[model samples]
Target: MKLRLTAAALLFPLLCGAAAPQGAPGEKMRTEKVLRMFLSTSETGLDPAVASDNATLSLLENLFDPLLRYDYLARPAKLRPNTAAAMPEVSADGLSYTFRIRPGILFTPDPAFKGARREVTAQDYVYSIKRLYDPTLKSPWAYMFEGKIAGDETLRKRYGPDVPVAGLQALERYTLRIRLNAPDNNFLFYLATAATGVVAREVIEAYPGQAGNHPVGTGPFMLGDWKRSDRIVLLANPDSTAVFHATPGHNAEDRALAAALEGKRLPRVDRVEVKIAEEFQGRMLGFLNAEYDYLEQIPESMTDMVVRDGRLKPELAARGIVLSRFPVLQTYYMWMNMNDPVVGGYGKDKVALRRAISMAYNNAEDIALLKKGFAIKAESPLPPNVLGYDPSYRSPVPYDPALANALLDRHGYSRRDPDGFRRAPDGKALTLTMHSEATVGGRLRDELWRKCLNAIGLRVVFKSDKKTEIIKASRLGTVQMFESNWIADFPDGDNFYQLLYGPNAGRANYARFDLPAYNLRYEQARRLSDGPERQKLYFEMNQLIHAYNPWVPLTHVLSGDLRHPWLKNYKRHPVEFTAWRYLDVDVAERARSARGRGGNR
Candidate 1:
């Protein structure tokens, strides 16, 4: 049933949580509960369709509702309906899929509705997905939909109600249908991503170029306050129908949370404040001083101070800080842009040059020195939790300076310049450049890389710039090589392999590695259901990567989170973003600690 709520009714909960359901008698008398944390990086904008940065797109996770979402507590995430009434019905051929969105859901009240409520509908979703392909948006995620959705390329994401669109359709008021050019089981997982989250047409029309600053959605939270690059505050959506509930999970953590928090109105905390602090020391100090309620992924530099042997130190544990450690579904590596003249190509010389460089760099040393022993050397494209990942598989290449030198010499990089550096086969200067962030950790990595390259008589330099600038240059194919990492979007091997897919060059394939054999294998593997036969293709694809090294597989990071004793019902989701709606803050204990610690004011 529609709530028939007014604008103030829709936003009051987000602003002050005044409409929140009352707790047990006398327990609800405390001040507003706030879940305060810090984001290591700054968010770019609110438009999910255009955003690729993890931090920026996450804002949409709370604001916009997607058709499906990964289970909040389940590992190797299972898809569950978010705004959808239930799972989409798939045809036998798997080309046609139909989704029935839950009715009565309304976008958080906005002036764009002209005082009338804008209930979310199938049309809104169609428009939202179209935004990703809108050429004007310059969306980085368009690659996910490109050539997959059976539609006229000329229409792009702008397929409208009157426009004759073939693949996407709003069949009924609350029903949507998506037709794919080919069969793909992973397509359902793509719907869960923020890139395809629904947006109101009225909101888009109202806000012209500044859609990022002004966001409206039917999710459990609303944008309350924002200060660019400094602080952001989110309030609970008063009219939201979302409630906190956990499914039967693999661990005791989810079971306990389910028992204690089932049926609670979403966004248990009154407000969420994210402070953008890029430096490790600043975030560490804030956590220690009780200025922040959570510290996510404590940087390697401070890993020893906060954790010992992967456990919280006794000194900090005495303060009642809780530690949760998990091997992140991510792989850190250096990707050589395959389009660049120096590094790009599938020729023998180019392949040998890349393989030699990969062998020259030490993964174990980088993990120990830069990651503070909090990571395992990655052997393949897929990280630990993804399907088709084989832990037994080891990389054919190993760290050996002598072998790297020999490989380079055989490839005709034998001439030496006056500076004791190797010259290209064509007698031209061969100076390799790498891009990294200008941070303390980045500098340490630079020192290690420079020393390693020099060991093989190869001249190398690092271009340390702002992270945003480096990313832009890399996407434009200007950067030669850069150490980067990819965290799983969904718990599937296809997600990792797609990074090297020739078609995904500028999007997920930052390395731009496009070999015909690898692309064909990826397509074949992607079409098959996850099983033994598909796994055989996975093995072949990974071996192809080893044969022609476009990427240097580094390490799979072991990340840990620190939560104050006052925080409750919080745990990391393997695939889901933040469970802030399911999280609880102990207002009384927080106040007591703040008073004792001289208050974070």
Candidate 2:
């Protein structure tokens, strides 16, 4: 069912007991706790293995613990030990990695634990990694370990759960050894991701389809209540004894954040209540009314109202709202399916068609008009702030409608129908189907694509589907073209390059681009450390991608998050999602802020 974020329809009644004023009797706020927030989209699920979307992963970051985690205040995204005793010991060959699990860590109470001790061990991580190879699960992130983990792909392809994976093994109760097929420098980064979060083996056996909804992990927060698409609550894990001591920051900004967060127990807020606010306007209004403590991403539609000259509006600033802006390691692009007949081919004509389409679309205009100058026009798949991203690089496909028309005309697409739309070489109407989610922003982006395609005399039609459905269709190679984005799973160029790798086709390679030369460079780059030599390979691969035009690199967004004054020690991470741990709420201050704002409640 489609979620509608209308305040009147979705918001709980202000008079209801659950919506009572802060510090009200029987509410968690009475104890000066509770962090209220909202989710703009419905989460797919909380299972780390299958949670692919940002919403689900965001929650899982707190619900589960990875061996290593990104330092909250680090700009370059430094990895630190979380569940591991320290960084894994790597062999000289870089193929074998050994990790010692931290002791005293226990999973939140669950039926799966039965009467046994809940202490996390190396065996738990071994069991979790094996789940990625489970064919029945069909995890989108399985590609992260597919051929890299020794014997994993073979077991999945040949044995099909009949045999165990030989690569990941628990050497002792506390030690785990992982053998990779090749030297992968980014392997540790993958382990730091939520997808590698260890789960209890018994939990999977106890709750089959409901494991995701009923999560049991060794993290700061535990799942409390979930009302499908309406609301989700995460309560502080009583079993958690984790405390965060601030690490030295690299800059003044980092130092300031560290000063505010130093020596604090994880999950300062006792509870996190996330309301479903699908509509941007409603979400922003809710924040203004003090119904929410923080606004995740500043809505593009409300950018002007909330921000002026890169600063929060004077009115909002007066109300004690703090705005944090940082360039995220993500790239939003429009993918052209290489498998489609009209748009796909290795021939000159087909390449010209794709290049023409890329040139016709103006990313600068999209940023100014649609994104309100909140995004950087991307010239390559690798966005700024990630390794191998070159600031000097320029996009070869500039906005040139005349050049686009000339290319199309020269490529035998010159014939125009009665309605003025260009026809294919075979005299068939050249109509392209672009798929997008049926959200407000999605519709706006679709309209922009329609405008640009029409300028080049090409007819464009939009196919609106749920975000999950569109993603599934793209992975299945059923969608001709679609809008999508990739946030870096790690700070490496290989993460972006692998999206076009031939073997990854029908998975992360939604464009179905299969160039042998590009794949070789990607493999070579993945094995090398981040340096000038590896950077050269990245540049070369990016050049090939630019010429191929499988995707029209759109924008790299500067995430703008607004937090109420009562929210303390809030710092945005460029790549990490576990920032909630360091955040603290001033309950009395929040009550005053809410009381001062005489809206609805």
Count clashes in each candidate, considering only residues at least 3 apart in sequence or on different chains.
3, 0
Sequence-dependent TM-score of model 2: 0.92
Question: In model 2, where do residues sit more than 4 Å from their true spots?
Answer: 1-32, 115-117, 159-166, 250-253, 256-263, 599-601
Q: Which candidate wins on TM-score?
A: 1
Candidate 2: pairs in clash: none
Candidate 1 displacement at residue 180 in angstroms: 2.3
Clashes of 1: 3
Candidate 1 has an lDDT of 0.82
lDDT of 2 by residue, 1-601 (tens): 3222122212222312235586667754235377888877778767898887777888898889989888786657788888888888988988898999888898877656665658999989987887877766777778888888887866777634335667778899999999999988888899989999889988888988767867788888877777877888777776665677556556886687677666666877777888888777889888988888888678887888798988889899999998878788989999999999978878888898899899899787899988888898998998998888889988877899999999999988999999999998888888899998787888888889999999999999999987767877887788999989998888988889889998888778999999999999988898898899998998888889889899999999988888899888777777775477777888778767767875433
lDDT of each: 0.82, 0.82
